[model samples]
Target: MAISRITTVEVTSEHIGVKGEPNISYIYSRYYRAPELIFGATKYTTAIDIWFAGCVLVELLLGQPLFPGESGVDQLVEIIKEKCVEEDYEI
Candidate 1:
């Protein structure tokens, strides 16, 4: 079976090893990346996949990306805006 292009090495069953510092490179599309990744976090667990899954689910339900950001910083802003509205937090 062919795997989807959306899947990345970070989605494997192996545990994510702890790094001494943050990684300079980030993977995955901006719309689907977790907050930690956008902030340059390198040591992360597989739980980041849950965030990606949530984005996919939202897109599937809405027929469009929930966070169609133009850039990494814009992606973070979009995510924060949506979350603030969801939690009723002031932006």
Candidate 2:
């Protein structure tokens, strides 16, 4: 499988793990959610996570995400219809 640019990865049922971004984020600190990711002292005095939990809670009541996508960028786009700018899309 390594030939012709094809590759194979082996996994066991018990070894399953997520292959993309981490959900835990200093950037995604629970106290901030708006049009963009805000950092630093701006993250203070606002219960950002509480807001997100409220949003998700509402979505759950509706039986779906208020917004959903196949990737994190897609998910963000669904949120505000704008791309997350200046990201270095590298491994």
Candidate 3:
């Protein structure tokens, strides 16, 4: 799943406690999210679809979600810029 702007996030349950089994997140839609992105006034908002496309691309290359950022802003900032060594990047 994907979200836009990340209105808010609940992290109390994400850290500590059992060291990672599973986590659930409740995301709120903002002024420039999903539907608005496609048809609303902010439909032209680039962040709308860009996130999804970026995700799929990560899945294809790394076989997983690109950035599991602790927060929304961090996630948005952490794009698929390649984690491998510089030498590995060049064929």
Measured by TM-score, the strongest candidate is 1
TM-score of each: 0.65, 0.37, 0.31
Q: Write one digit per residue (lDDT tens) for candidate 3, span 1-91.
A: 5543322323353432231322122222221123322232322334444544555555556544555555544443343234546575642
Model 2 alpha-carbon miss at residue 23, Å: 11
Better candidate number, 1 or 2, judged by lDDT? 1
**Over 4 Å off in model 1, which ranges?**
1-25, 86-91
Candidate 1: tens digits of C-alpha lDDT, residues 1-91: 3323343335433333344533322555678888888887776556576887888877767767899999888988898897776557766
lDDT of 2: 0.41
1-91: candidate 2 lDDT, tens digit per residue: 1222322334455433233423223343222243333222332223544556665565546555555555555555555542333364321
Best by lDDT: 1
Which pairs of residues collide in candidate 1?
A: none
The weakest ten consecutive residues by lDDT in model 1 span 1-10
Q: What lDDT does each candidate get? A: 0.69, 0.41, 0.38
